[model samples]
Target: MTNAHHLQNNKPQDIAINDDWFDVLKISDYLFAISEPRHYEHTVVYLLLGSDRAILIDTGCGIGNLRRVVEQLTSFPITVVNTHTHLDHLGSNHQFSEIMMFDHPRSRDLSSNGASRDLLHWELHREELVIPPWPRDFHIAESALPPFKVSRWLKHDDVLEIADIRFRVLHTPGEAPDHMCLLDQTHRILFSGDILLNGPVWSHLDGGDVGELRDSYERLMRRVNEFDVVMPSHNTPCQNKDLLPLELAASNDVLSGKAQPQVGTDLWGRRYNKYDFGRISILSKYPQ
Candidate 1:
């Protein structure tokens, strides 16, 4: 519940990329948060540096040159680890040579087919959804997410070590079936994907299950003491571990029918019942 604004307000002096599309914030000397503030999702990707290599968490909505921005951050041969195959998270996966993904059918399908202009047409054309001063080279009419090859497919409890740093891949599927969270227990940081964010958690989307989301939150709660901070993929970057209980209680209330929800509709016109819980909310399919 601590003010997360300090993560963004304290800018690092060593950032080399001076682009308008991406905002890079230094969480620590070894970790950085790369975010897309212009987009509605306000998606964030993480960069973790070790002694010999570096890991780049989810890539943002491919609006700008994420690979270029990452290159300036570290020169340790970046490896892209996608928390999920959602279009917003994997847009820049093609830009990286080595890509890691969860072993799931949905992840394979999206990575192979990529996101077409038609699929992203609504999001790209929405002027109000995007903040002004868009990227100079990006053209909404011609934009399309390119497919990237998955160098390796990982599973639950898989531990990845990059020199000195280690991340345990925890399969916490809810937001997406392939969604996974990277737990750096040594540093007490959890790179929570779309599962836990600052805004609404969409369990109404295709392949999203509210029950599974509740289970995932419950699982994280069991080991709440393991992590000190959560680096979420949307809205804010750093969140205290105390957020786990709040989200869990919200999900529990919704499932038990103890909470009343408001009708909500997305950009695609899909209807959902939204349960608001202040800093975070849950969007579930109606009649659930």
Candidate 2:
């Protein structure tokens, strides 16, 4: 992965938030990577600015005031877009009003009912996973994700025009049924959700399908040349496009049974076969 070209310190000193819970890295004049580095998930959300509006792609774990941090960054109207409805990604969705999500049953269910407290127990209670100095207002025991209304349901290939910039939505399910990636052809960037990350990609969860995950990688590989940089949602923020083929190869190996996997258990105590591939790994359910 190449080093991120962060904005200069003098660029906008007034926009910087004094909070330590979130690490905001300026990737470009119009893009910012907002992340919760203190948590185990290291969930990274992105903010893309345009002439008329700004798009916040996925809200990181609701451990802090993301809305306040975002409001300090841009003055344009904001739109929240969930790459998928995973709790870690949409934790702060309720904090935003103009929200957009991919039209899927899982997305609808989670959006309406909200995630239960049980779903967050692993992250909240795991003392070993948390770093020191959590946000003063964040109560681990009482924190729970709230339901948010989706203002628009997006479809595959739909073009989102935020004034001068545009993002083409690609429905790339596998990490979740509602998983999607945004492709900015003009900017040469791919906002890959959980599908392609620097660490282990989980396809062993309840709503995930290893087979479908492999297919999604194949679909992205077909148009790999379209984007030069990959802005993943977890672990690393900005990565070279070279990581795409590596992930695709790992997915293919897992499906073909050519890769040997080690047994592992998640926070929920469900067993999964973890296939390690150096920088990237694939976690899938054991074959019956």
Candidate 3:
């Protein structure tokens, strides 16, 4: 198995060689993170190869050619799944033939219109240079979420077996109503989409719920012992299991008013309280 880092170090011509568009990180011989480090979102999509098939988690911001990048990774039959219907996460959904997601109305709506440039502008404005700057000749207005249909609907507890690895689907809603996390029983690793991350967990967005997110965190805490590593869909590729508890604590603090919240506004001009914990932060609207 070639180390993903080593594989990433050598960029082949077949792949989209936009130096600024994507950063491919190999987690294992069969697992890789296709990250957009240059973008403000630092969006990441994962590719997991099994003996028989492969899976892609989240398609990433549609600023570059993601399909070409994945083609460079493996030739196995690939199945795409989105953690939620958020534009940044599902931006490249149109590039794939088969897409599986939770049975959700918002998911349907997002997949239909392609995320609006109106909303994507908010993210583009936050761009910061990490390694590469934005792609040359790239304009924020030119990017739009491409519309695609869900090939299948995945239910909670649906077990996806790709060769020797078995992943159990976990319905983790808080960030988005249709949010999901995958638990790999083979590796004891949790593919925690946007539910948990080192960055600000946005529960202030439409269809987000602070109370429900707290409940979701509590549920994950109970099953914390089951997974060893937590892989999120943003900024960083992997995080320690201990980070879960810290995030849970932050959520609890927000719910209980234990920590003071600083006023902050979201991209849409809506005011929300931002609670910053050392390891993670929670941005949520005060409960109605």
Candidate 4:
């Protein structure tokens, strides 16, 4: 509410989504994400109030102009993070100057290209993009959000203390080694990054691992009783207070064995399928 530009100007058109809290079309005070018809048109970055300041998860491709949108929303310093360093997620990193990344071999090892080539292709063509992403730039671009810095490298079990909130980092590697989830026990909310341990949730086809993903899902399910809401970086959030238990149960079965997957669908008409594979071989079986 303290942001200098609040209500003073209009938010960027490309990055704005209709607010859907309680189904009311009001601008969400907690977070806002813009979508381009690319990268599966995955929702990017969740803005929320922390114990101390505002926190932003995954700066979707700079194409969405996420920083500009957040700038008008809050005066608090934004803590930029990532689900993983794929182009769609990390496009806006260079803008903040000091962005944060988890300390994992895949995350830390940025030898020029910054992101691994294989993962880059996968996150992009997860069955062709829908978000209408910006024109491809061959050269890797650093953050362009500006007026900030990037100096946070999170670790497993690490805790982040913002102005008044505390977030526990769970290094649940699946989509990428640097992947993590933020547990806000106080609010019973888990900001699930790519560690979305669910039906076909693991993208083993894109540098994802079956074994690590299973472990991540298992770890989360064991702690499911502690949280009530899952605000995933992509896809719709599950605010059902009683849904965690169901998600947890299904998660356990998937970890120990394969699921029949009675039926499931992602927001974008993405249908789920069933599959079986060894552990690095973890992959999704999507219905074409």
TM-score of each: 0.92, 0.91, 0.86, 0.66
Which candidate should be chosen as best, given TM-score against the real structure? 1
- Model 2, span 92-171: residue lDDT tens: 89899999999999999988998888776565435566787768877888888878899999998899876677778999
* Candidate 1 C-alpha lDDT tens digits along 111-177: 8888777876665435777888668988877778777898889989888876777778888877787
**Model 2 weakest lDDT span, ten residues long:** 1-10
Q: List candidate 1 segments past 4 Å from native.
A: 1-16, 123-126
Which pairs in model 1 have colliding backbones?
none
Positional deviation of residue 140's Cα in model 2 after best superposition, in angstroms: 3.0
Q: Which stretches of candidate 2 lie over 4 Å from their true place?
A: 1-16, 123-128
Question: Candidate 4: how many backbone clashes?
Answer: 32
Higher-TM-score candidate of 2 and 4? 2
Clashing pairs for model 3 are: 4-26, 114-145
Question: If both were scored by lDDT, which would come out higher, candidate 1 or candidate 3?
Answer: 1
Error of 2 at 128 (Å): 4.4
Order of the predicted models by lDDT, top scorer first: 2, 1, 3, 4
How many clashing pairs per prediction, in order?
Answer: 0, 0, 2, 32
Could you tell me the lDDT of residue 66 within candidate 1? 93
Give the 10-residue window scoring lowest on summed lDDT in candidate 3.
Answer: 6-15
lDDT by residue (119-192, candidate 4, tens digit) is 44444433345433344442324323222334877888887776666678888775666678888655556777
